[model samples]
Target: MTDSGIPVVFIHGLWLHASSWAPWLELFRENGYQPLAPGWPGIPDTVELARADPESIADKGIDDVTRHYAAVIDTLPRKPIIIGHSFGGMIAEKLLGENEGVAAIAIDAAQIKGVLPVPLSSLRATLPVFKNPANRHRAVSLTAEEFRYSFGNAVSPEESDELHRQWTIPAPGKPLFEAATANFSPHSPAAVHTENEERGPLLLIMGGQDHTVPEVITKSTLKQYRGSSAVTDLVEFPDRGHSLTVDSGWRAVADACLDWLRKQNL
Candidate 1:
């Protein structure tokens, strides 16, 4: 098929499905862009089904998720402009390293190999899944309390409750373990090719109050891209948390992204 428009793909992080990108899809489409958001392989079609069979996500690794998204990108007529959050963001970076996209944005991206900073809040946020070694092979779901702490601390209690009730689902455990042990594993899937000269222009967006992937985490990822000739920029929202993409103020984040794309002449 001939490429019809500037294709934009949105990749959601853990605990949420591709449906989380619904609003953004509408927004991007209204702006004359063709947007597609594909979930990790085997993800259920609805939030209820996903929550019902949470364990279905167990044992999925980074390579599996990356390959699924890469295959989707390959179907596009031209390289896409990819955007991702948390683990999804890391996958976007990995794809960009392979020169699979035209440009990319990573929002509150999970730490990949060579990103050494580990903040207290990040550890606390991740402890729910990583504290237990058994969880590495299990699909883990977060409690409302844990979700509030990790994703919605900056939002209202009611909003936090709704976010947990609606979008939260079980996430695979293997990728978390892989990322946690990336430094020790020579063949870690958490690794990314940061120095690839062919990498398209990239941007990293951070939510200042985000506990799961904090400023340090995103900054460390940016630091890893220092030697790259491709453009890499970082933007922070001081009052936002990890849920910035889904919170009430999500449009502000979207606007920033659209603005960045415009600047890139995309």
Candidate 2:
């Protein structure tokens, strides 16, 4: 943000802790950037703690979650560049809108929910949890099989299974409910109130094979923000899925952002 040091932050999606961003944080550090990855409210910092009890904080909402990260960003030495995946991507976009210094990259992001283009894949990906109204106050864990279909579709079965074992934690259902039931109103929980021109160089990346946040969502979001003067770029990776940031070929995506950073002279 100040151009005084490396500026990069990684935000993980639902069912994942900040540690999931560790791989990318290391990559960014190697490329001469400072990295910050923080977790949501009441979320344990370690995977062991998260696995030990998934129901501890199953009712957290988007605003509460956003405020937690807002506090984290407040402590930063400067307005760090942000990179987020899935739900985290949504929060990053909100942060970009709220803070003038935020530069952002959203990967496989799901915008508020009522953007008029719900691809069948996107619906199917979220169906496991959203099919029931009771999920709102509960925590949802991905079955190995379900995780494979929604997230690991980009990789091998074995690799996907292992990543599933290592990364996912139970996620609060309230955020999804709010996103799904965003009320089609300008004043809503899912409303990010973003100004495309106010955001710094931003990028939105999508997975070609992703079911959770399909390519159409990225395209539509770009179209909505096309009027902004800020640089906005959309990129799609062949066969990638919602778990693009955590999978084996994640480096390519991260490197792409790094290349974009060079182009922006950030």
Which structure among the candidates has the greatest lDDT? 1
List, residue by residue over 1-266, the lDDT tens digit for candidate 2: 35556667677888777798888888888888888787778888898898788787588888887888888777778888888899888887777877634588889877763466878887777777898888898888888898988898888999999998898898888988888777565566677655556667778898899978888888877776656677778888977888888888988998998888888787
Top candidate on TM-score is 1
- In model 1, which runs have C-alpha deviations exceeding 4 angstroms? none
The TM-score that candidate 2 achieves is 0.94
Q: Residue 130 lDDT in model 2?
A: 93
Q: How do the predictions measure up, each by TM-score?
A: 0.98, 0.94
Candidate 2: where are CA atoms >4 Å away? 1-4
* Candidate 1 per-residue C-alpha lDDT over 1-266 given as tens digits, one digit per residue, 9 for 90 to 100: 33667999899998877898899999998987899988788788888898899777888999999999999988988899999999999999999999999999999999999999889998899898888899988889999999999999999989998998889889998898899999999999999999998889999999999999989889889999998889999999999999999989999999999999999998
Per-structure clash totals for the candidates: 0, 0
Candidate 1, which ten residues in sequence have the lowest lDDT sum? 1-10
Task: Please give the RMSD to the true structure for each candidate, in Å.
Answer: 1.1, 2.0
